[model samples]
Target chain A: MTSSGGLRGYFVRSENARGFSLLAPTLILLVLMMVIPIIMLVARSFWTQSGMIETADFSLVNYQMFFEKKIYLYVLGKSLLISGSVTFATLILAYPAAYFVAFRVKKNKLIWLILITVPFWTSYLLRVFAWKLMLGYNGVVNSGLIGIGIIDEPLGFLLHNVNAVVLTLAHAWAAFAILPIYVSLEKIDKSLLEAAADLGEGPIRSFLRVTLPLSMPGVIAASLLVFIPTVGDYVTPKLVGGSSGIMIGNLVTNMFGRGNNWPMGSAIAVMMMISITLVVCIYLWLISQVKKRSN
Target chain B: MTTVAIDIRGVSKVYNPGSNQAVQALDTVSLTINDNEFFTLLGPSGCGKTTLLRLIAGFEQVTGGEIMLFDEEIENLEPSQRPVNTVFQHYALFPHMTVAQNVAFGLERLKKPQAEIDATVERVLSLVKMKELGDRRPNQLSGGQQQRVALARALAPSPKVLLLDEPLSALDLKLRQNMREELKQLQRETGITFVFVTHDQEEALAMSDRIAVMSNGEVQQIGAPTDIYEHPVNRFVADFIGDTNFLDGEITSVNDDLVTCRVGSESLFEAANSGNHSVGDQVTLFLRPEKITLSAAGDASRQGRVANIVYLGNQAAYTVDMGDGIELTAQARPREDGNLPFATNDTISVDYSARALRVLAK
Candidate 1:
């Protein structure tokens, strides 16, 4: 193997093959975990299903049923709205925290970073459960409000709603949103801020013109990181989402479980994946356009 | 004399006061910068020149005393509220903006009309001779181009006072020389008071109308370049500005116009009185290297052996060691025949006029 001879020599001689070899492990894992499963799902969407098991036959009945049935589209739309709201809320909350950590809190920055991520040290399920305990009807918040005489009874509107799901998801991924934003904000050259001030801009205007624009990449990254996962998140909606709060993830789960409609479930999964990919592409394109226009 | 543009009265800066890490960066330094004049604060690093500039620009607050811009006190104003802009050393142009946009930034802040902003941007860009490349981003331009854009951006606002903090220090040697002349011309055309801070003595002397030489935390001297160069007030001012030879001596006699100082035991040098030193006081006489004349055969005032000769293109500097073991450098222009008048290890007599010497109190 040390000498350049035979197979080793051929490997070293071909530049394309060398690059392929370097990427082979990741390529194989992606094919196994992602590509193959997606292909199977797409293929299954075109097959016929009797109850749960999909028959190996070519049919478009699942897609046909999707257009005929209105519930799936409603759930998908609701899921999108919830995901977007969570992304927006998470970003709005994260930017200030990230900005403070990046610019204001100078000493012990590492400690602040660790503290920002301290909530993630616990299991995701545990964090959701903690939120469940706080926001439940008879939870700490209601009891505290009742004890203070601010509320006559435990508020029924606190949990098991779209707002509850959004609040929980936003809190859950707060660290994910903050970390990337903080990294990008921290990378900005400090002299740029001073230059803006010297050019007759006040602190607020300088931040809007320089700081926010420079940190857009981080905001985009954080937005995608939180939005993509929460769109298909099953656990949060399952625990907190009531009947009206059920999203597309619950629909897919039901189709795979008691509904026993594998083809329909596969069709919905494929459609959801396609829609997400389209949204992300459009989002990235818009960010690039904004950056170009500013430049 | 021009009217005072910016009056810095006994301003000082102390960082992190009441803490163990506290530092006094500037002492009670007072200076009056004239309108339409190119004023420079020249000093080495840690000499508080930059701190003073920052205080004037309102980037830093003075720990004590007042700063007046014309007739109003400006020490309490914010940086943006003050009518001064700085050209940073690194030319901190906005990396995400085009040259035109960067130049228009200040005008836009002032809410100037769109057409007026465009005209002003064009005028300043062309003033700096960067009219064609206004569409390029800062990163797309070269170092010199970026520097010009920085200058254009600062000048676009037409500020009352321009503060340049070692602006040309980042450029190459050839570019630095060209920019110095351009900067002086710009200052003249704009007729704005310019407060430039630099550590390069040559740059300060070449461009500034008046220079304030600083050391430690105090202003050592302030005068025109020629005054500061020919007649420095003290040893620090003389040593910091240019090449000089200091000969230790004591004032032997103080006449009406001249003070005679005795060097070692045999040599006595006479110079005009510095007005501060009297008879019998210890003093050091400063003489420029080029002012001393070297001869082979003459009964000159002083004599030394040529220990080493540095051959510059037009002139050669002879390191002459006197008989008393004191060393002095004398520069001699090459002869028209293209032959060196003296060589290394040759015994030469050195003579300098009394007017060329400056006696400073030790």
Candidate 2:
């Protein structure tokens, strides 16, 4: 009973103990929802899938299938390529927007931030469907082109391709890229720019030498945030991607839903996670190298 | 012939112009800083010294009049285009760059040869005695180290003039004093004009070849350190430079340069008249505390009882009530035994030379 009272005193006195207790509910929920599901998936990836009955017997057959199938390799590569382009496109679009909002817009900054995240309030599925309508045959772009007499016929190439997937994905993940980059840009000391200018660096050179390099952490974080989820995303591809834009996520979805191959789906998911972690690690290492070399 | 490095003519700056909240920061201020000279702009905070410095650096634009750098009009130029560099008060060293990179920044911006940039960066870093800490970032070093890096960075391009905006204000006393000596020596060695701004009068007096005393967006006086301290034209200049007692009185008799002033209702004191003042003219006389000598009892004419004694090392300040409600502060050196001579309520005689008690017009 004395020990129990002492433990209570420790809980009350120690900030770390109290902090962990405050985080306990969220931690337990994450363990149940995410960690246990990932563990189950790993276990299922090692099991054998025979026709309709997936057995508890551990084997490398599911992993072997991933290498043996050419379709899986093609789709996985295409998915990675699409996500990579999406990440690149979003960064290019987001940087200037974030810079403009951070440096140029002095007043009503909250309004600008609210505008960036406003798109999130609507349904993600609805937005993807909206992109489909915009990119589809006889859609806004096609009709507008026809009305302007710019093209003789509807551009079928706009839809049913990797272009549509990249476009939709880039648009969806834009705010994630912008907000972090904005925060980093805003955090930079304004006097550093003045000092650079005083040292004879013009506006363009100052931005490149001082502003660009300093905001790299935000750029890296935004890259990972967009790249990780987009690789496994299937909804935008399903709506606007049509036949050509189907990716690894589509295959995983198919194996789980119609194919009833949970073990195969689990294997593909695990492989995707592993490959992404490897890519992000290399990217982060390269960024750190660049930062150090510049210094 | 002394060439002028910066010739700021009738320049004025009114922040937020044409608005109700417009503040007149500088008003028709004209000053010429000579080349290779250590000139100081000395004033209290918000006294337009910084405004004048910024105008010369092209950081802020002038509402009227022109600024000439080395006899070339440069008021319209951008801060980057101007051939001047600033050592900001806070150092403003780039957090992302090492001390070497920061020092090399200006040379790199000028597109100098990499070899030349390396040599200049090395030279300037060593000049500030920061050669060993080149690889360390600004945050990694102490305040004084960062200050050296800032100075080295500003000097790397060999700017025609260096504008130091109270750079030593961040450091503690000992470091600040050491830096002040280094900076004065640096100016002499480099032969580049340095325009230093500070509120600390002692720093201005110690380092400047010429000091410009300013107040309320206008220059009060411009002269050598001794000229400013000894012969301040008005009450503000005398009070700002150092500690001085203001003895307000009316001139009873004028003797060309010397005037006998009736002070404290009954006492008459002789003072040097700066401006043309006739008999019966009201004048304010400024007497330096150190100029007045204090003794327990002597042939000194003015006698006063000590109201308060403040013990300062090497010197003690005594507030003396010189009869009839006239209180004046005076400083005296410690005795041969290293003890303060006067205590509270002790009557002491005050003696000051007629030349030391100069009068400024009312």
Best lDDT among the predictions, by candidate number = 2
lDDT values, one for every candidate: 0.90, 0.92
| Candidate 1 TM-score for chain A | 0.94
Off by over 4 Å in 2: A1-7, A10-19
Residue A51 C-alpha lDDT in model 1: 53
TM-score of each: 0.94, 0.96
| Candidate 2 lDDT by residue in tens digits, A1-295 | 9999999999999999999999999999999999999999999999987788879998999889899988888888888889999999999999999999999998899999999999999999988988888988988999999999999899999998899999999999999999999999999988899999999899999999999988988998899989999999999888888899998899999989998999999999999899888888988888778776776
- Worst ten-residue run, lDDT, model 1 chain A? A1-10
TM-score of chain A of each: 0.94, 0.95
* Candidate 2 lDDT by residue in tens digits, B1-362: 99999998999999999999899999999999999999999999999999999888888899998899999999678899999999998988999889998998888866678998899888998999999999998989999999999999999889999999999999999999999999999999999999999999999999999999999999999999999999888889999999999988899998777899999788888998665788898888889998998887777888999999899898999999998667889998888999888888988899889988888877
Q: Pick the candidate with the highest TM-score.
A: 2
Candidate 1 residue lDDT tens string, B1-362: 57899998998889999899989999999989999999999999999999998888888899998999998998668888888999988888887789999999899977768999999999999999999999998999989998999999999999999999999999999999999999999999999889999999999999999999999889999999999999888899999999999989999998877899888886778987868777789989999998888999468767788899889989998899887657899898888999999988888889888888888778
Deviating ranges (above 4 Å) for candidate 1:
A1-28, A292-295, B262-268, B295-301, B334-341
Query: What are the DockQ scores of the candidates, in order?
Result: 0.69, 0.78
Query: How close is chain B to the truth by TM-score, in each candidate?
Result: 0.96, 0.98
